[model samples]
Target: MAKDNRIQMLPAEWRASTTLSGVYALRMLGMFLVLPVLALYAAGLPGAADNKALVGLAMGMYGLTQALMQLPLGMASDRFGRKKVIYFGLIVFAAGSFMAAAADTLEMLVAARAVQGAGAVSAAVTALLADLTRDGVRTRAMSMVGLSIGLTFSVSLVLAPILTELVGVPGLFALTGVLTVISIGVVAWATPNPQISKLHEDAEAQPARMGEVLRDSRLLGYDFGIFALHASQMALFTALPFALVDLGWDKVQHWKVYLPATVIGLIAMVPLVIVGETRNKLKQVFLLGIACVAAAQIVLFAGLGSLWSIGLCLAVYFIGFNVLEASLPSMVSKTAPSDLKGTAMGVYNTMQSVGLFSGGAVGGLLFQHYGFSGVFGFCTALLLLWLLVAACAPAPQPVKNLGFAVPPAWQGRQEPLRQRLSAVAGIEAVRFSSDGQTVYIKALQEGFDQTAAEQIISGAN
Candidate 1:
């Protein structure tokens, strides 16, 4: 049979990806939904008035635990199986939700939130995503997951008021618990098992060299970008709720503002993103995003008390936030060595966890003492620092994606095959092993011919 080289969408895999992505997004949405209203809710809880610090701890400790446990859990998934790990995580998350729901005081809620953080399984979900997709379309598949999360953030903000209005804070936690349970059903019944791609890292692959990954400045740049992006997000949310309240909006109606800001931000972001990707100006785009974030912080610091002014600042902030959110992974993928993609992502996620924790923790303390201006000031300083780091960082070479198939007879002659594959036009990196060989050709994505290379490899064999 002739090999097809066309870049076609995966119709068959869409349903599973969509379902699983929704499940992942829903989990994240549960956490984010409370962001815009948590401050008000916390102020009302018994003992919350005495120690708002505990509330901050409760809010941010989840990220700390999440960062600590993510790698181990992901490794465990490799050993114990993805579904099993994910199921366990979901159960733990549900338990945390229930604990928070049943809490009589702020202290209990904090403990429950920390327990919820203990269930961090982002790496496992990502590993499963890679497991379920073919090499050629894996990035696009992953993008669907990214898109789901983005959509969830936007939708959760819009829905938070409505959900909170109907069920209140405790009910929101309960609803999240229920949603997680439903996702387990979706996982068991709907997701397909792709014949695992031996070409990519498997459950049992030896952990890649951390030293090498850490030393790669380019990868570190991408990691820093992720950290900064998430940190900014968490920090902004810490004060945004209170800021809205001071602007005369009630907690229940805050989503009215969120809905429009998010929508406008989403709309504004697409064009800038397209221009960056299409025009090969990703570095320029990234720096610009940092600048925008810094500017937004200034705007927020100056004008948060007025509803219209706050809206305007948010419009600016989300424009930067959304673009950077979409681009960071792509930057990571392009910068990371193909074999170490999993390891790089693991480290990147760890950085994100650190950011999430620090952002909320620091933002909370800043808010407690210095008011909203201090919170935005902190974000501004962080962004400026990040901008400097990114500005000095080296830009990545655009990698091309092309591959060759190994014929049956020469499966054992992998090293020589890698040598030959490397000689192919536009091929830049090659990884070949006895089990299933993969050739990562670096050329323009659209310019490479997958079929012709397959024929060449078959003929050579």
Candidate 2:
């Protein structure tokens, strides 16, 4: 095939990916909008006085429920329908947001947050996306989803402080509810319906593969890394707002610190990621990111009293945070068995939610007992342990997923097709759909003989 003849997304595929990305981003924006202001706002609620633990619970409660509901809701999408489950999840999320808006106490807020989290729709949305797009274009579609989440986080960091100042926490929660409701309409009208929705091993978790994914030590390491990353994030935010306030920055002005730190950190991350990918020094780059995060914690622990010093620390933290956040998933994909990728991601996402809850609960408890020292000390220690785990783990080789259209004659001849593809140089693993219409290959990033594979796929060999 000529270079320009490569498969590209059709108009329908483009519409599906973009609209679904929008739907996913809207839901995530609702969740992220509260991260910066939740702790400080919750502190003023009834039953929260001097009870930072309760405040933390209020802040992190959504993660616990989200973790518990993700798999079940995903499976429910299989049994029911994709759009139906998504609509249901959105309604539940909206209800919780409204409930949270009316909460008068920390306890009420925690319960409301849990309700908010029960609407886990990520897996279903992903599965639907896979259903709508051909395998060759799926990765591009998925990247859009990831990009939306990153953009949402950046927007939330800048907008949260200003929004909080204008309407207060209760009003923010109400606004989230409204946005979620609007997302339901997007799902109904804007999002395209899939012709067929079935279990897609590349996109949805499989029950039989659970043990295989869980037993992989390398995959487990990536899972732990994600857990640590998000836990540290939640813990840091649990105390950061108050720290800024004490440093003489008003709640509304906190964006000044976050906006610059996030922008600069993102700018700094580009070159490191480029070098890591282009030079094959991913492990080195990954470790450096870990060190940056740990160093930021140490800076905070040493008590940076000035706003500028704290801002610098935040910039350092975001640099590490963004790098790890971006690379960890890539590493997981490289490490996981091609067929079990979805299962591995399911487990990875679950651990992330668990980490969020743990960080908030523990950070609050630690801060209440030992002040900022305890919070930053815990974050520093966690990242150091993660760095050690990452250092000792096997380095990941660069690889990419390649999908081929299996000829109709190849149906019921899995063994032959598998053998032929497996014999191709640099093709590490081969998996086929149950119907045998598609073949997924894991191949080395370099030395993949695409022409040879294509010839075999086209029956011209």
Candidate 3:
């Protein structure tokens, strides 16, 4: 295909990707809206007096529960159907939201948040995305979902202080519950169900592929990169709001700092990632990002006394954060066997949750005992370690996506067609479902020719 021809419009499945992602945004808004404001409000509650540690515990406990349940829920969706599992998860999330909304003390909030986290549905949502779209468009669709989450995080950060002042944490929880209910209706009524199949029986037959994924030196490096990235993120937030307070910025004006910085960070992140993936300099880009992260932590530690410094640190932090987030997923996709992509993502997400819980809990303790300097020190160390690990990871294979139209004869020759394609050189894997009328192939570089493959189909007919 010519360069111009290679660029395609966003496929139709993007609509469902956007809608499902909106549901995630709604859920996250409830969770993140309180992050900046929670510690301040907890001080006023009856049992929250001087126990900032407890506040930290409450903030991060949800992650622990979320981590534990992600994969199991996803596997369950395979058995019960995606929509059914999604609805069940949403109800669980709504119940947790209500519990948190009703809580009068810090301890109650902690328990309630755990319940909310327990409704882990990321895997289910992912499976739903896969079920609703063709494989060719699925990556782009997932990108939309990712974009939604990032945008939601930005919106929540800007809105959190203002919303917190007006309705408080409890009110935010109620709003989340209402949005979740709406999400249920959307899932049931609006989304179209795409056909599903076991496309990679060969990969499944070799159960050791999973062990390979787990033990793969390169993926492990990226896995550690994710854990460190999130851990630092959790630790930093433990003190960021208070640090800004000391610098004379009020809660409501937090958006003033966050909004422009987020824009700047996003602007810087996109180009670097494009270069990294297109040029095959993934490890280099990932390491550079970690270096920037460490620098941000250092800046945070050195300059807690001024608002300008805080803003600069935040700008640096977000730039690094956004780049790593985008690059990591692409790396995983490029490196993972197309067959076990879901399972690899499942494990990656679980690590992220583990980081979240650990970050909050460890950050709290560090702050309570060692103060702000300690939090920065902890986070800085994490970034440094991540940088080292990322530097050592093997480079990912260059990706070139191929799309093919099904031949008219494919109607009756599904198995034969697949068998013929499987024997072709350079083709790594093929998925052909007669009912779905689609074929997905992952190929080796410079081996398979699309025109030649097309001719074979024509001759077979």
* Alpha-carbon lDDT, every model: 0.74, 0.88, 0.75
Clashing pairs in 2: none
Model 2 misplaced regions, further than 4 Å: 1-5
- Per-model TM against the reference: 0.92, 0.97, 0.87
Q: What would the per-residue lDDT of candidate 2 be over residues 189-212, giving only the tens digit for each residue? A: 888899988777777788777999
Q: After superposition, how far is residue 217 of candidate 2 from its true place, in Å?
A: 0.5
TM-score winner between candidates 1 and 3? 1
Model 3: colliding residue pairs: none
Model 3 lDDT tens row, 1-461: 21114545355475678778887777887787887777666656778776768777877888999988876787787778888888998899899999988999989988988999988888778778766665456666677888888877767777888887788778988888888889889888777665763332111112245586797677777777788888888777777877777777777777788877788888999899888876667678777788888999988877587777778888888889999988887777666665556556666777888888888888878888888998899898888877777766667776544445465766667677778777777777776433435555666555565555556555542
What does candidate 3 score on TM?
0.87
RMSD of 3: 3.9
Highest lDDT among the candidates is held by which one? Answer: 2
Candidate 1 wrongly placed segments (more than 4 Å): 1-12, 193-199, 202-208, 400-407, 433-436, 445-452, 458-461
Q: Clash number for model 3?
A: 0
Clash count for candidate 2 is: 0
